[model samples]
Target: MAHLRDQPAGVDGITIDWDAPIRVSDGTVLRADVFRPTEPGDYPVILAMGPYGKGLHLADGYPANWRRMHEAYPEVAHGSTGRYQNWEMADPEKWVPDGYVCVRVDSRGSGRSPGFLDVLTALQARDLYECIEWAGQQEWSNGKVGLLGISYFAANQWQVAALRPPHLAAICVWEGFADHYREGARHGGIACEFVKGAQARQMFTVQYGMGSRGPTDRNTGRPVAGDVDLDDDVLRQNRRDLYAELLARPVNGEFYQERSADLSRIEVPLLSAGNWGGMGLHTRGNVEGFLAAGSELKWLEMHGDTHFNPFYNDRGLGLQKQFFGTFLKGEQNGWLDRPPVELLVRHPGERFEPRFEQEWPIARTEWTEFHLCPETMELRTSPGASGTLSYQPEHEDLRFRLPPAGHDREFTGPAAAKLRISSATADADLFLSLRLYDPQGTEVTFIGSNDPKVPIALGWLRASHRRLDTDRSEPYRPVHSHDSIELLVPGEPVDVDIEIWPTSIVVPAGYVLELGIGGRDYSNQGTEIENAMYPTTGVGPFIHTDPEDRPAEIFGGAVTLHFGPDVTSYLLLPAIPAP
Candidate 1:
């Protein structure tokens, strides 16, 4: 057993219990660090469990994100020493001072915990359930526990909350994806490489057994990984190959089901904070999860900015504290009186206006359809005369543009595209982008989760995997059944519906809206910004470029857009009428 050390109260009036043991169901001990108020009375607990090392400081593990966040929003580090800040987890300095106990646990096989490492699986969720129960039973705990964090820390909450542990009271999921198949590994049946990159840079570096090879926590002067040093081969044998497993399981089967959250089973009070800029990875899950969750008391708050910034900022922290205070601490904070939906409505020039609403898709939304006119490459209110447009899938794309708007229009909900198309080969990959152009014809882009220049919305689909799940499909959000593949015969046009993830954009008068369809990922032709982990090429690391997934023989071919009286292709947008 490792020696447990309890540090004296610091200048900030917080005490720390280091290397605390939390034994799970299998009797394997997981490690955690507990921070609580020194004045000591039982306090409501806020817990986070994930693969990221609990000992690794945010400044040390993710320097780029830490530097960028502090540089842009200095308030993120305000009111705290910033020494206890971990990636995506609550800063203990901030929470402990507010009379909340903050506990950070290293999941099995990562950080200081020693065990086989397979993340986001049923086992991981079970471990989290045990941890929550453990926190509740602790003498220093007030018998109520709340879950709070961003991204990985947030994503796991949905799964664990379904277990309904006695201690689990509420959750604040900030920018987390609930679906492992659709949102994390694959997007519209296309293999996304983001998982691969994430595993390499985020997980592998601080993996358990790295010992001397891994970084040390500056605060404790101890290795972030365990003390026992292990060879590279031994380390490789301990962790699962996430990328290989994703490639092996291309469909949403038992593998994905075991990892994804059962939204229907989540009954705890939920506050899902989503980012408008997190289109490919984080956006869809938050909106869809909030709607599907069985929780009667749930709220959705949407904002725009870099993914990590909002979670730590005043707006994000305020919402989290209010919700947790009401549910976990039993405070009469009037949280129940707040509206169910809160939106930081986005507009041109990086401006966001805060608006309270009754429900998502805004009850007053006007579902408008803009039909495609292939002859002139225009989007019209009604279908035009029959015409056809073809483009080389490998080299070109078909773009249809809407004329300058007569008045400012707000598109604040879900969007989709219905197209009639054919391929020269048996299979073709379709990449769709919803874009806005200024009066001068310059493309309008916004800061995304990782990329600085992302378009209005993006969607993707492989022709062979275009089968829709009728029971779950909506006109605006088409859910695809990627279990089966149906090849397309040459020159035979077929109708396919593609779901463009939810987006919020207020288009000013004289601005043009365009729909671009291509065989490859959409690029804005803007200079790429290199980040700490990956290069930001308009879409960030959420790219699909695996050669095995898109073999040239099957996916590389000429694609045609058939626009005729019988074959009508159009873009459906959620248009909000003027109040």
Candidate 2:
């Protein structure tokens, strides 16, 4: 194996162990790239486990991301060689110099590993737990292990942590989803196209396919998959029909439960980091995980951004190191005394100022609701003209907003909406957005996970997935059962509670808060940024018009919003009082 971390003298270097073997309980051998201080004693291990190829460099695999990242944060190149950076995983270029051993493992049937490839399944989580145990027993390990990474790497932390591997000391789930069906593949029972798009652009590149051999790692001078190729039938059998399988499990049940984490079972020291703009996939998980995890020493940190920025940047790394340092290194850093919730309150022009709070839905929140008045198209404290507005899927939408001027206030924590609505057809897909506007009526949007012009926050619900469990449901954050579908009877008015994901935006005085109920994603009139992996539009690949999920007959219909005394509809916002 070839080693990196070579160059100038007198500079501390890293020892790279390429294609390191990690044996799971079932005898499957996964591959990993280990990076640690060349002059290392035993170091606490920071492991990132996922299907992402460990051998691929961020620059080569995700060129658009590399360009965007370096352009935005040039400091990321400070004090290190950029040769060891991988996509969505811990950068050895940064962590290795800081005396931490960073391990990036390629799960079974990925990269150089040989076995079946099924992502986010219980089997993968089991393999992850075993790998953690193996890492702890390694000669270069200090018997303490922490999980840290973004997206896929972060998502799996919740899964394996639930397994309670003895070696798993701490987890920093940065921008991850807890529920597979709800927050991931399907939202409110409607299929998300991102699952299909992301898998093709990300996973298909390195998947062990027949008649093909994967790329070679430039640093290691070895084939990424070691010439692993099988018959077409065999390769087909090894990989999963990811999208089709998700379609089969239309609702959250055994299929989703197996992939989802039981937050109560995750009792390890936790630092669930969130991205305020990651409404589509990452926001809800971090919010819910922080609230539901059984861990006593848990903290939540919400930041602003494009999903990957914070992880490698000073803001995110600082919080992660503090959390892992205390639990993994046993260093008594002042991490414990820090507030339970650390939020970066968002403002216009991508401004995010840090705000520390003791709890989410900050104790001083005014649970305010803005009722919908159809005629004036206004969001009023008191109901106005009682009428119904028609909605055509992806063709038309309605908007409601506060007065032209108001107090400068901060809306933090989760939000929800109660809609008195009916569909011309038996089913309708509900898309809600909490937005901001300048006094001049110009729409204000924020940068979301993959979308550059995303709204403040968004929530989706299929009319059928509207059943809420009283035990778990809260006023501002309503939790849907999603266990069964409750179809709407034709032409009947139903009160549906749509749980808008957590968001934080500081409204300037004279500015306004607006809510948009749409049949489709909120489109941006602005230009789109091009990314190597995704089409950089307002919604990224998280589109909702899968023919199987939203058939022409069911989703193509007229929907109506009713407003009156008996059928009250409103937007529940967490108005945090200014301190």
Instruction: Return the top candidate by lDDT.
Output: 1
lDDT of 2 by residue, 511-578 (tens): 88888897887677744555545665567667887788888688778898987777778888888877
Sliding window of 10 residues with minimal summed lDDT for model 2: 1-10
Clashing pairs in 1: none
Per-model TM against the reference: 0.98, 0.96
Tell me the lDDT of candidate 1: 0.89
Cα RMSD to native, each candidate?
Answer: 1.5, 2.2
Per-residue error (Å), model 1, residue 73: 1.2
Report the alpha-carbon TM-score of model 2 versus the true structure: 0.96
- Judge candidate 2 against the unseen true structure and give its global Cα lDDT, from 0 to 1: 0.82
